[model samples]
Target: MTGSTGHTDTRKTALVVGASRTLGLALAAEYLRRGWDVIGTVRGSGRTGLHDLAEASGGRLTVESLEMTDPDQISALGDRLARRTLDLLFVNAAITRGDLPIGEVPTDMFTEVMITNALSPMRVVESLRPLVAPAGTIGIMSSDQGSIALNTDGGQDLYRASKSALNQLMRSYAARYADDSRTLLLMDPGWVRTELGGPDAELSVDESIPGVVETIERHQGKPGLHFVDHQGQVVPW
Candidate 1:
């Protein structure tokens, strides 16, 4: 692919997890538009918007299947992509069970949200970190809601707690791999209008994802973990 610079684009590969629709799908498309080879994962055999993007990508986009909650699926995906080197591995998965206070949340509901939003993403990162290039990036779709220091108006307690847990776990992961050269990012895409963000969200996917991708690209060679928003502004810890 030749870019606007009139030079042949050295294609970088990106694996966008949970990319069937919404923000994940948009991220995949943005990367593809920027001359990157994109592998986007959906949940099942059924067709999705990502499949549509792949069909029109002239072979630049490959669609994979993944159930993020299942460790077996994650391991299987890691094995399947073992030969390919990835420039970016981004895991984007989140769920919210209404606006229930944390205390009122059922044990099962709490477990499901935690696993989908926090544990499963970390599991995927751990399983697939080997496939990423040494100077590549590993990012998770986090939210500003996760910032404890900025939680002035308290609502959506369960969702807040889950994102906070995700951030904390990423911190631990960064600490454990402190010497690793790869860049780690916790990206806050803001309140984009998606199923998860609801119809009343302030920003659309178009408004959020390009900046998110650019932020990731700008931080490519910078080692260590950063918690930042779509515009590359540092989000509070």
Candidate 2:
């Protein structure tokens, strides 16, 4: 039977990257509330929202330190977690350049956004893929902005480029791992109120996350890549 939080543990584990606050933290909390063992990462050694969640989890959550931009950190993490199995792995780190257009954005800022939103997540996935059970799911936090097919209006230029690049890169990664059994996902959680999504955003953490977690649970054991929203419907890409 599922717990009050609507998930059955079976001692299943999840590794949530970039889980310091906002949606990432919420994801960790939802999983912990559901009785799943959660390993959540914050970028640095400093205290973060995830630390608070860890303290309250009654030992179901473990907090790990990782700077997603640093490959060395990722490698060390791989060493530490080599023997453990992750039933779900989600990469949720991303940064926005404050509405800067693609051409107007500074080179350094562009680089940071792309690396954080795209390259680093893939690096983490490649390093950690072996640790996921064959039936597990690996998901990356993407946005509807990433959909090339849906970009007719065009805005959030730098942010949009980063996500679109992420979508493309993950597609390449998927092609490379075409025969792999684990389910792969590109998740679009919608425009939610958060530090990143801005206050006027339509959804709340409470509104989007349950369905997000539920969608993930429903996709278990399914293979190939899906770009889906909080409701598990496809997002064009």
Candidate 3:
């Protein structure tokens, strides 16, 4: 690929985890549209919208299988992609269990949410961080619900807690890798209309993802960590 400046453009590669449908699928598609080679993952072997995207991507997109909650699967993916360098690694898996009060949330449900939304993403980052280019970006799909300062409405307690935990863990990950050249981001894509966002969401995927991609691109070479929304505004911790 070549840029308008007549320089050879090194086409970047992005790994979008949990990219079967909804926001994840949109993200993968947007990256591909922006001239990025994308490796998008879906859980299980089932064909998904991502597969359809791959078919039309002119070999720029590859679909991979990943059950994010399984450590073995994560490790296997890491091994499989070990030879490739990624310009972006974004983990986009999350699940919500209704609006139950924190105390009323079942132990099993709590465990599942925490494992899926919090622990698993960090595990993926750790396992795959080495494959990221020296100046690459590492981003996690975080929500404004995770912001303690913005939690005054006090609803969706369980979901809120999981995202909060995700933010905290990403914070620690940044602290530990303080000297790394790669930029780290926790992105809030806003309430887009998707399966998780439900029918009442205020924004469409088309309205949100392009800006999210731009925000990540804007912060590329700035080291350290940032918690920002799709509009490039920083979200409170």
Candidate 4:
């Protein structure tokens, strides 16, 4: 990693945002398995799947609190880990309603989806960017539906719009920091079977995350952003 301003910690460390369950939990667990110390965030004051995972992590994992939608919480999270140097900061955004067309979706529902999927994650990234080592990696959990050029079939409606917005936001963020040596990744983990991905998804978590982790490793220390899939293949913008 290329950091000059981050803390001088020797252990490999990762800050996995929204890590209370599903893909986030799995990713945190995988990072631990790969020999990194993990700090995972759950939204509020309740026991979650991540708590159990943390218990079994043999002290390799620490659970923190964050509600990505809130600026106060984001500020608090930044302060809480300010001195810490993060080897990897992966912002795992969430939520999708149904197959309704964008025109049919309610305004409130659309707002929630866009904020949760696009805006909040970027807020998290901006707040935590200072803590990431210059040699570190920053990632956002994206989906292939975000590909605007690949929209021939026109399914997933608002979900596609949110991810596309996320991709564009990250692209702008990357452009602003183009000279920085840190790696920026928009990683699509495929349609894995999760609460978010639904039961009908083509891939299982066990089948996908290992490749996702590998793709992140491949991008480490590389400057600029890559919109890539779990297998390190680039997706069309």
Candidate 5:
């Protein structure tokens, strides 16, 4: 039977990337509360929010140390997870430092942002591909800034380019594996009040996640490149 959150009591597995805090933690908690076995990935130890999530999940959750830049670690984790099937895989980790205009942004910083935000998630997906059940889903946390149709003036070049690249990556996955029952989606969580979004953003993480979760539910039967907002509206892609 389904629980209070509409998730079934059946033991499902989910792997959440960048689950140190905020939306990531909230998503993990909601799944655990609904009886899904959750695995959260964080870069380091001593992160308070992750510790709290582990404690709150009551043995239903496991946290793994991950460095997105390191391919070897991702491969090892994939090997470890290969014995079990996964129901959901959420790629949420991304970086945006110094939003200075493109011309002034240091090349190294821009490269790092692309590596973390674009390439890393693809690598994770590749590593974890074997673990996803044929009926499972894979979601990439994407942004509206990535939409070529929506771009007018390109101010935040690095961030915009990175997410746009991610959009392409997700699209490629869908095209190559279209016959596979596993669903692939590029979701825009909207402008949320968080460390990455700042206080002036349009929505809170709490407000965004539930609706995003609902969107995931609604699209459970249909999948491809779904550019959806928190309110379930299709954002331009």
Candidate 6:
């Protein structure tokens, strides 16, 4: 989706901010399936299935190393991708520790969680704003736990806080960049079975991903921070 020509079609370009794992990789594959060009970001230490996916995708996919928390790395990546504009950007890198019940939460753990789960991805989106196509979309992978209106119990203090902060930040970002077709979506992938979502999660990655893809495609023209669930319902802010 190159904005230079003002088109958001199947051949549009996509950038997935974190693709070292199942969800990001699956999203990239889905994009390639739809006949779009995809660039996925993996960490220096992680082993991504990108090579196999790229091979399968023929020539529509590419992978690069990214450290979302580092501003220099973010700038370098933006410079690298400056030539090819992006139609979609997915901020999917996040961390979660199972046990962080209120008073038991440590300071360092809280900081780390905030940095990885919230600040880093926000920075990546901000840095790549210019690359988004005119009628393109940006999605932040948030959670149901992030909804302050629905949270009656607070267990995962760090994770919850970080996501909540992300929600707020993206809401403001959407408003700040309103009046253009560049829409921002704050999506909750629901309880999917991933390394972070754990073994007993409700939805499989396959089930949740299609809904997310459809929602993103449908909402590209709309402007706002929509809290969409895996089933494509609007989650309360």
Backbone clashes per model, in order?
A: 0, 0, 0, 5, 0, 2
**Model 5 lDDT per residue over 1-237, tens place:** 256798756798889988888988888887877778999998866675877888877788889888878999898888777666788888888878857888888889989999999999999987787888777888888889888888897767889999999888878877887787777777889988988888999998888988877777677756555777767788787
Which runs in model 1 stand beyond 4 Å of their true positions?
1-9
- Put down candidate 4 lDDT per residue, 109-154, tens digits, no spaces: 9999999999999999998999998999999999999999988999
Per-residue lDDT tens digits for candidate 1, residues 25-127, read 9999999999899999999899999999999999999999999999999999999998788999999989998999778999999999999999999999999
Q: Candidate 5: misplaced stretches above 4 Å? A: 1-9
| Deviation (Å) of 166 in candidate 4 | 0.3
Clashes (candidate 3):
0
- Lowest summed lDDT across 10 adjacent residues in model 4 is found at 1-10
TM-score-better candidate, 3 vs 5: 3
Candidate 4 displacement at residue 156 in angstroms: 1.4
Q: Per-residue lDDT for 132-229 in model 6, tens only?
A: 88778888899998999888976777788899999988877777777767778888888999988889999899998888899888888887668898
Candidate ranking under TM-score, highest first, comes to 3, 1, 4, 2, 6, 5
Ten contiguous residues minimizing lDDT sum, candidate 1: 1-10
Q: Candidate 3 residues 1-237, lDDT tens each? A: 355789975899999999999899999999998889999999999899999999999999999999999999999999999878899999999999898988999999999999999999999999999999999999999999999999999989999999999999999999999999999999999999988898999999999999999999999999999999999999999
Which of the two candidates, 3 or 5, achieves a greater lDDT against the reference? 3
Stretches > 4 Å off in candidate 2:
1-9
lDDT of 6: 0.85
lDDT of 5 at 235: 77
TM-score of each prediction: 0.95, 0.94, 0.96, 0.95, 0.92, 0.93
Q: On a 0 to 1 TM-score scale, where does candidate 3 land against the true structure?
A: 0.96
Candidate 3 stretches greater than 4 Å from native = 1-9
Give the Cα RMSD of candidate 6.
2.8
Candidate 1's TM-score: 0.95
